[model samples]
Target: MGAAAAAAGADPPPSEAAATPAREDQQHYVAAATGGVSGESCDAAAPPAGGGGADDAVEPVVIDASAVAGGAGEEEQGECGFCLFMKGGGCKDEFVAWEKCVEEAEAAGPSVDVVELCQDATAALRKCMDAHAAYYEPILRAERAMAADLESFQTEEAASHSAASALASEEGQR
Candidate 1:
C-alpha cells in the first residue's frame, strides 16, 4: 500500500490527519517558526510584570544646607544673648571703634601714653569677646540640641504619614 493510504486507514479522509497529535505538533512548530528577534535583553524592552523602574521604588531626599544653616544660626542667636548682640549691633561697632583708636595711637609713633592707652583698649576688647563667647556657649548648645530633637520629630511624622498613605492605598485596592 502507498504511505498516505496506509496512514489513512483504508480510505480515511485527508482532513482526519489534522486531528492527530502530529498535526498539533506541526501547527505549533509552524507558529514558532515565524520570523522575529530573539535572545535580546528584556531591559531594552518593557520591564517585567508588576515590577516598576528604579525611580518608582524610592525617592531621594533633597537637603537645603544653606537654609538649614540659617535656621540653626537663628536658633542659636535667639538662645544666646551674646550671639544675638554680635549678630545685631555690638561686634561690628566695637571692632570699628577699636580700629579707629588703634590707628590714632599708632599715628603718634608709639609714645608711652599712646601705647598704654592702646594696650588697655586691646586687652579690654579681648576680654569682652572672651566673656561674650563664654556666656553664650551653653545657650547655643541648648538651642542646637532642641533643633536636633525637632528635626527628629519631623522626620518621624513624615515617615508615619507615608506609611499610613501606603496602607490606605493597599486597602483601597482590596
Candidate 2:
C-alpha cells in the first residue's frame, strides 16, 4: 500500500495502484494530523501479519491543563484588591490616564520621581479594587460556592466523556 494509505491505516484500491506519487505541491494531507504532518512516519506502515487492525488500537488519554484542580479559569479571578484591579481592567478614559502616567515616567528613565509615580499608580489601582469588595466575605463566599459547583460540573463532564470514549458511541446509547 502507498504511504497515504499506510498513514490512513488502510490499503488503497488496486485500481489506484498505478498512479504516481503526487508532487510536493500536489500531495494533499490533513492539516491537523499529529506534528501537523499527514504523511506516515517511517515505521508506521502496515501492522505485523498477526497484529490486530489499527481500529483496535486505543487512543492514549491526555489530561488537559484546564482539568488541573484549582486552575485559574476565566470565572476564577481576583479575590483581592490588587488582582481585581489588574484583571478587570478600567474604562478607556481611566486606562488612558494611567497609561500616560506610566509612559511619561518610563520616558524619564530611572529616578526617584519615576519610582514615586509607580508607587502612586499602584496605590490607585489597589484602591480601585478595594472599592469593589465593599460588601466583603458573605458575597465572596457565595461567588466561591458558585465557582466550586461550576468546576465540579466541568470536571465530571470531562471525566464522563473520557470514560465513554472506550465504548462505541452507539453502544453507549443502547
Candidate 3:
C-alpha cells in the first residue's frame, strides 16, 4: 500500500507470513520516508559509528523521539513539527482520532480494511497539519539543509580516502 493508504490505516494485503514463517516474537522496525514530511531530501549515508573527528561528522537528527525519551512510557515526540502533533503537541485531537481508528481496526482483526475505515481520521489529521504548515516549514527546511551538508561531507570523505589510498600505493611502489 502507498503512504496515503498506510497513513489512513488501510489493511495490508496478503501476508508473506505463511511463506517466510516469521517467529511470533520477532520485532520489526518500519521507517517510512514521506515526501515533505520531515525534510525534502531522501535518506543519506549514516554518520560513522562510534567516535570520529567531531569537526568532520554531521550529527544525525534524532528522528524517533520516543527512543530518546526512554520508550512508550515516556512522551512520544518526533524530529519534525508535523510529527509532533502525534505526541500531543499540535493537532492532537485529530491525531487521537486517527489513533483510535487504527486501534479499533486492528482489534477488528486482519481481515478488516483498516485503511478504508480510517481514511476520514487520517484526512482530518492531514488537514490539521496542512493548516499549520507555517510552523513546520522552517524546521523542515533546516532538516533538509542538514541532510544536504551530511551528503556533501560523506562525498568529500570518500574522495579524500580514495586519494590517500592512491598516494599510499604510489609510495609503496617507490
Candidate 4:
C-alpha cells in the first residue's frame, strides 16, 4: 500500500528528501540570480549576527504573486500541517513556495554556482521560511519536551528491569 501510494505521487519520495542542501541552495541561487524575480539579491536575504538577524535578513522587495492581489487556487490548498502558521492564520503560501523550490532543487543536476547564478528562488524560499517564524518556537518546545520524556522513560525502564533481574536472582539462590 505504501509503495502504491508513493507510486501514485501522494507525496514526495524519500530520494527527493535525501538530496544535499547545496543542491537545494543552488536552485534558490538560480532564482535569485535571475533579474526578473523582484530585484532582491540573495545576500540581502541572509540573517545577521544578533542584530535583527532573522527579521533583518531581507532587504525585501515584495513581488506580486497574484495570490496577494487575490486568487482562487491558493485559497483552496490550505495550511501546512507541520507549521504553527496553521493555528496563527498566517501565510501558508510561504511553505508551498519553499516546497516548490525544494522540488526544483532536487530535480536539478550538478548545478555549480558562481556569483552570477540566479538566487531569487533561494531568497524566496528563505523569505517564506522566515515569514513562518512562529513555527520555530512550538517545534523547539516540542523537541525539548520529547527529549526529556525519552530520557526519563529510559532511566525508569532500566531501573525496573534491573530490580526484576535482582529479585529473580535471589529467588533462584533459594
Candidate 5:
C-alpha cells in the first residue's frame, strides 16, 4: 500500500496507485503526514489551562479605609471634602456662601469663571474648613487612604494582566 494508506491505516483511494515507499523515506513521510511539534518538554507541571483553577478565579478587591480611619457611622467620601461640605456636615454657612457666589457668577454669564469671581467666598470657605479641621481631618485622611489603596490595586492588576499577556504571546510564538 501507499504511504498515505499506511499512515491512515486504510486502503489507498481508487485514483491513487498502491505503492510502498522505500524504508529510508518512511520517517520523513510519517513526519509530514502528522504535522505538529513533539518533544519531552511537557514533563513539568503544566500551567492551569483556561481558568479552571481557584487561582484563576476573578474576584473584586474592595478597599474601604473610611470605616477604619473615620467613625464607623460616617459616610464614605469618594472625593476628599466636597461631599461632606455639600451635605452640610460642617461649615454649612461658608459652603453656602461659596455656592451662592458660584450661582450668581453662573447667572451673570455662561463663560464666567467661578474660581475667579468667587475667590473671596472660596477663601472664606477654606478658612472655615481649616478652623474645623479637627472634625473632618479623620474623614479626609480616610478618603486619601482609600484613594491610595485603589490606585495600588489598579496598578497591580494592570501589571499582572501585562505579564499574562506576555506569557500568552510567548506561547503563541512557540
Candidate 6:
C-alpha cells in the first residue's frame, strides 16, 4: 500500500518536510528595455509608487534664449558684406565699390607699401592677402567668370522671351 501511495505521488510526511531547509535557493533574471534597466527586478523591497530611482524622474533639457541670440549675433557680425550681398540680403554699396577697388589694386599687383598694407590688414582680417595671393586671385577670377555667365544667361533669357512674344503675335494675326 505504501509503494502504491508513493507511486501515486502522495505528499511527503511532515517529519521529512521538517528535515528540509527552511529557505530554498532562488535565482532572479533581470532584462533591460530600450537599453535601460528593468524596474521590476530592482530589489525585493520596492520603493514607493512615485519615488526612488533617478531614472524614473526625467528633467527636460532647456536652452537659454539670450545665449542662442548671442551666438547668432556673433555669426552675423562675422559674415563678410560680400556674402550678404550674394545671398540677396543687400549690403552697403561701399562694399561692392571696395571689391572693385581690390580688382584694380590686383591689376597693379600691389606697390611695396600696399603689400605692407595687406600685411597690416591681416591682423584684423584673419588672412594676409599678400600671403594668400594665389588663393584670393583664383577666387576673384572665378567670381568674375560667374558674374559674366550670369549676365549672359539673363540676356539670352530676355531675347528668348521677346522672340516668343513676336511669334505669338504673328500666330494671332493669322
lDDT for every model?
0.37, 0.35, 0.44, 0.37, 0.45, 0.32
Candidate 3 ranges beyond 4 A from true positions: 1-85, 136-174
What is candidate 2's lDDT per residue for 28-63, written digit by digit as tens? 221112122233221121111111122322222221
Residue-level lDDT of model 6, residues 1-174, one tens digit each, is 665334223221222112211111000000111123223111111111111222222221121223223544522322321222221212123333333334445556546333343333323222222233232232234445566888899999999999999999999999
Cα lDDT of model 6 overall?
0.32
Best by lDDT: 5
Candidate 4 residue spans exceeding 4 A from truth = 1-76, 84-135
lDDT of 1: 0.37
Could you tell me which residue pairs clash in candidate 6? none
CA RMSD of each candidate after superposition: 38.3, 26.5, 18.8, 16.6, 31.7, 33.1
- The residue-by-residue lDDT of candidate 5 on 47-110, one tens digit each, is 1111112232222112233432453543432322233223333565666576667657877887
Compute the lDDT of residue 149 as modeled in candidate 6. Answer: 86
TM-score of every prediction relative to native = 0.27, 0.23, 0.33, 0.32, 0.32, 0.26
Q: Is candidate 1 or candidate 5 better by TM-score?
A: 5
- What candidate 5 gets wrong by more than 4 Å, as runs, is 1-90, 97-131
Instruction: Pick out the ten consecutive residues of candidate 3 with the lowest summed lDDT.
Output: 21-30
Model 5 clashing-pair count? 0
The alpha-carbon deviation from the true structure for residue 114 of candidate 2, after best TM-score superposition, in angstroms, is 2.6
Off by over 4 Å in 6: 1-134
Residue-level lDDT of model 1, residues 12-124, one tens digit each, is 12322223224233223222322132332111111011211222221112222233245544232112112222222223344334545665765666454553655655454
